[model samples]
Target chain A: MTARNLLLGLLAVLIAAPAVIGAYPLAVLILVLHYAYLGIAWNVMMGFAGLLSLGHALYVGLGAYVAAALYASFGLPALLGAIPAAIVATLAGLGIGALGFRFRVNGVYFALLTIAFAEFTRILFDHMGWTGGSSGFFLPVEHGQLNPIALRGPPVLFYYVALVMTAGAFVLARSLMRSRLGYAWLAIREDPDSAAASGVDVFRARMAAVAVSSALTSLGGVFYAFYYNNMYPEQIFSMARSIEIILAPIIGGLGTLFGPVLGSFVLTLLGEGTTGLLEHFGWAAPGAKQVIYGLALLVIVMVQPAGLWPWLAKRLRIGRDG
Target chain B: MTVYLDIVASGVLTGLVYGLMALGLSVIFGVVRVVNFAHGELTVAAMYMAWVMAGSLGVDPILTLPLIAAALFAIGYALQRHLVEPFIGRPEHEQFMLLLAVSIIVLNGLLLVFGPDARHVAVDYAYDSFELGPMLLDTVRVYAAAAAMVLALGLYLFFRFTDLGTAIRACADNLLGAQVVGLDVRRLYALTFGLGCALVGASGTLMVLMRDATPILAVQLTLLAFIVVIIGGLGSMAGALVGGVLIGVSEALAGFLLMPSLKSLFSYGLLILVLLLRPEGLMGRRA
Candidate 1:
């Protein structure tokens, strides 16, 4: 029940998943990993540093649009496109953090600030002509280019790429939790006043948290654009999209390393299963998945406020030290 | 010149209605100390209800306002008594999460029952406008604005003079003190929430006369309400009114001068400015 064992088991299943399953199921797995990556990144800021942002979509949209626009318009390589994507997202995060933190806009006020900024960005992008506006940006698929390094390939290749990214993010989150900055985040989360009184540079630590979290989230945005082969500001920057990203870490267990992964898998599998079942029975349920997610969040908060991962860890004795 | 005057006049009227929508949010925050993320969903639901009644019974939206408000009051009361009461004493973040859950449920549930298509209620005076001097104004806008102002004034007077209103304010100011004075704090919580829902429901009925009702509009409306609340100052009724009008006018002017899409940018920029320069809001009492 050690962390290493769990990770190894997960990797084995993922590596063998495409071989055993159909393309549709593999796509579902990719979706799960995508959310897992976002959840982990978001947790660093929200669960660790106590900055509740309901608008992480700003970074995701910014990254997606930048990468998509660059690749489509300028014919830039996708790998190199990530640099601008990450920088833009990070700088935007820093600007927002400075505006909010400097003004001492904490708690729900800070959350509102993030939502407002995201909405503003969405409207801005919706009108901008270069990024295709509401028409959407699509990366031209080079007919025969199977470039793994550039992140250009078939769905299966993208699936493995997503797995690798998710695994890498997991390691990053783990190391972060054990690092000095991670401890600082924990301190700030628990109590900013006490943490500052104890000589933790609260503002610096928070700004760093926002910067790192936003940078990581933008990578997922890049993957989303390339994997889906299109980027729509409306779809990527929607409030629902941001809510979807946060729900996984929340339901899995906020601040826990494996929580996002576990939550993502459970929610995604359940969602896919429900869709499959509905299709089989010949029923139409448009918002069923969201209904299920909402119920899951409510039940978790009401029944196990700390999240399912902590309770599961205790019962199963996995990561007992954690 | 006339065009600019028309925009400003319409903006002021719309601002009054916006303030009315935000009044319930401010009241709930002031009395219950919980931010209801589902407030917009409640408003949308009320709009749909008004729409249905207007369509079926052949009555005006104004006529169905009382009925929609009553129904929303019942729904809000039950939700507060059952779903929200347990978490009232928890941390602010936990309460926030609970309300967010409520928002998701209500929003998607509405989407489930009513498809994603936008529905509008047609009235006799839907497109009718009257000219005043060199400016023209929509009749519905003027009526909605008047109703909103009247409701705001009524709420302010009720809070000032009524015993139940005094008890609610007492609870807001000092939870323990209110309880020690033998006030039914739990009932008051439910009542406050119900009253807040009723106010929002009234606004929704008025809104259906002017705009289309879509499930997705709930989030936008919720954000708009928050903007109004923040601009006016949180937990202040008067602030909500002033803030709403200010935002409405600014948005109209922005749309006229810049582009229509940038109007939200103007409102958000105003919010950030107020947060940095005067977080207490224009009419909010210094705490």
Candidate 2:
């Protein structure tokens, strides 16, 4: 069983699974994939580079809003709009990465600083009338259910599209992790001073990783808006949204490529199942979902602080406990 | 001039309350190095407790400080000793996840128990106003502000003078060193958290006097506290106070000077600017 064969087989099943799952289930899968992509993107900097960012939602919102505004105002095709939006977001991420790494603001302070940048952007969007301000901006909806080539139209199409994006993201991250740059990231993660001493350009490495991670995350966001046919500052540029991206990777396995996908699956399935169960029984509350999610995090950490991926990997004889 | 003076006065008062909230956060971080995302929720709970106590005992919530603070102190100690203490030496990332989880539980638990409806603290003098020159201040806001200032000062003095305070500060400064010096680092950890909770209770009481109590205050107020903490400097008491003052004034001035809807945005923008310029915060020591 070659790794490439395994990957191809998995991709094939994913492409087909959406067609069978129908619209409602596929929609859920697409949301999970979006988060999975974001998790992978964020894991590049946060997990691999050992920098925590509580505000990566900024990139996501920027990507979505940028694409939507460009398309709606000028009637531009999304294929082009999405690319530019992602580049803008990537540039923003680089700007922040430069500022933080230059000043040596690593660890928790870096997380807080990321959050500051996000909130700052949210405020700016709230005031920028051209971005539709606080009322929000809506993208043109393709009403009729049509087949999409890149998973852009029907829920099933979106699911496959998302699956491909998430799959590509995972493969890219995994390969990158095993490369020289990846080793430099690992060294930076272990100890920046030592990594610097060993000839690793710690600052440049972190900044590069952040730029790529945020750019990819923004690309996910661009797809997110086109898929939903809407964009809003409050929803996209939120601390909660950032948490959504961070949670998946952390839950699955912070530094692992497969972690985000596993995390998204577990969190989404568990959340949906629990919510479905509750809705059926009429046991609904405003914030109960968050409570349940929190409890899941607590339970996971207490029992297996190493995260779900590592735990499962050990059980499957794929890896031994360190 | 009168309007400006009134705003500044009000902002300073509000700043005192925020300072109290940030103080607890700083203390907890100082001791355990855990960000304690649940700190805001605990403060909301304290406010609820104060409201409940006032209603049950027919005492002014302002007067019920001792009881509320004591009860909250115990709750804080218990939460720290049980939930947070276990994660003390865990990997930094795991600790954040754990704290975030606990925060979510506490927030939803509050919603479940109290529901989504805003809970108002019924006080006789809540609306009474006190006038000085051409400026008028709500009596409760004034008293709350004054009480908060006194409490903050008292706290500053306590941390500066008392043996327990010194030990806690010692632990905060260097956990390993404190243990080597025969300080019960565990007890100091719980004490620091307990003190933080007590201060939060006081802050909650003051907040109720100035604003309505709601479950979602946990979320909003926590964000505000984070802003204050970051602006002031992490783990610095004076920094929290100064940060609180600056945020309060900036929020007020931004609302008046700029778009009415963007006061929060303005303060957050300031935070980013500060980070870009000085990542250690306004008054924080560089690591």
Candidate 3:
């Protein structure tokens, strides 16, 4: 079957997923979609522009705080808060990207820059009394009601929201990968010096990638905040959170369109499965899931550096285009 | 004025330990050209090592420094030979992810083994203070700083004079050339990594004297070490020391002047400014 047909069929399955799965599984799927969405957003930079940002949590935290704070303080609906969330996150991304690119901080240094910014922002949020400081910023939960506008209510509402987000991000990433700017990004990714020599506007392409990626990720952050009904600076802005966002794209396939989604599903399922097994055995520890993630990353990078999606796709002969 | 001096004094002492931590990172980066993303976790592991030794053997934390350093050296050597060697010339992201994975494992492994409680080493001199003029200094800080300084000096001398150190430096200078000249480049890389781990591990033992040891400190300490190395210069040994002291001083002052929680603000600000103005760092040779 064609990639298009496969995607369409998958969407159909996802639309009907909540109907088949129980509440717990549905919640897990929401998390899968969440990571899938984030992975796609992050893929724009690392997968496309060859910029390794180890701290995408910066944008996630920024977006969540912006939207959650606005909703909590001004009674602003999350739907409206998304715009400002995107803007604020985009600006922050632009600033970081500009600084790094302008100063020619490539590779690991660039990654460190992202980490520094994220940690810096986390500490800043921890001290901001308006947002409840380190104590945490909490949203008022609306019980037994559906309010998609304010993003308050049941899990089904969020499940669908997350679903739409994942689909939209996948489509957006695909289009962006095929666009003229995307071509430039690919060229720059291959060789920035050669791309510059060929008049590819490497800096601008890289900057644009960061901008788009951060903006998209911020929206995911908004969804997370409203769905969870609370935001903790420590948890939300942690390097662990950033690492979780990147694992899907890295594990599935770096540059492939289907990689992030596939990776997200595999990781979240494996994580939930492990958690379930561990809980059953009374071996449930806080860091066991993270340790599993780290091992998966290690094995993937060592064994299949190209990631699972590409390898699986090639083996299955599923999609030549993907 | 005395308060300022006192802060500076304490910052310098603490900074020396931080420098020792960053020095290991610098040395590893210098030779292996692979950033040990697990640097902080390794340090945390060392801190745990010290804590365990203190609790079990009833030995002073200082006595376990050499033992922890040796253990960490072996761990680093094994890590470099098996895990890090293959990814030497790979893409930066792959290298990062590999080390990041290792870091996650090490960090979470600590959590699993020790749980989430903060572990502190109680030395007989924990509350003892030394008065140098009007400024009072904690005995623990003084001992930690002195140990770190002596270790740093030893490292400096080793790099300057020893055959192994020279071989490592040669490997760092030109990998291909070193290989062509019949040098065991891979072995040297492993040795360099071991030395780096030892430095950080020793510093970790010192660190427990001044503060509590918690797995949660892994990420922050890692970033702090990175900041020290970056501000000092990525591959410069002396730069790590200078950068560490600078960061420690700035952190102490920021804690004093602003709220204590915002101390990292200044260090990050310094990092940004350095990245912008002089990416090679103050003491580093131009990359």
Highest DockQ model number:
3
The order of the candidates by TM-score, greatest first, is 3, 1, 2
Interface RMSD of each: 1.9, 2.1, 1.6
Q: Which portions of model 3 miss their true places by more than 4 Å?
A: B280-287
Clashing pairs in 2: A151-A157
Fraction of native A-B contacts kept, per candidate: 0.53, 0.67, 0.70
- TM-scores for all candidates: the values are 0.96, 0.93, 0.97
lDDT tens digits, residue span B1-287, model 3: 99999999999989999999999988888788887899999999999999999999999989999999999999999999999999988987788889999999999999989999999899998999999999989899999999999998999899889998888889988878899989998898889999999998899999999888899899888888888887787656777888889988888889999988788777877777776676543244543
lDDT of 3 by residue, A92-171 (tens): 99999998988877777788889888888888889888999899999888689777888887899999999999999888
Kindly report which residue stretches of model 1 are placed more than 4 angstroms away from their true locations once superposed.
A320-322, B278-287
Listed per model, the TM-scores of chain A against the true chain A are 0.97, 0.94, 0.98
In CAPRI terms, model 3 is classed as medium
lDDT of the candidates, in the order given: 0.88, 0.80, 0.89
Query: Total clashes, candidate 1?
Result: 0
lDDT of 1 by residue, B1-287 (tens): 99999999999999988898898888888788788899888899988998889888989998888888899889889989998999988977788889999999989989888889999898999789989999999899999999898888898888899999999999988989999999999999999999999988999999888789999989978988888887787666878988889888998999999988778778877766666665443234432
Per-residue lDDT for B92 in model 2?
Answer: 77
Model 2 Cα lDDT, one tens digit per residue, A83-127: 889889988999888888887665766777788789778878877
Ranking by DockQ: 3, 2, 1
Question: Where's the lowest-lDDT run of ten residues in candidate 1 chain A?
Answer: A313-322
Q: What DockQ number belongs to candidate 1?
A: 0.60
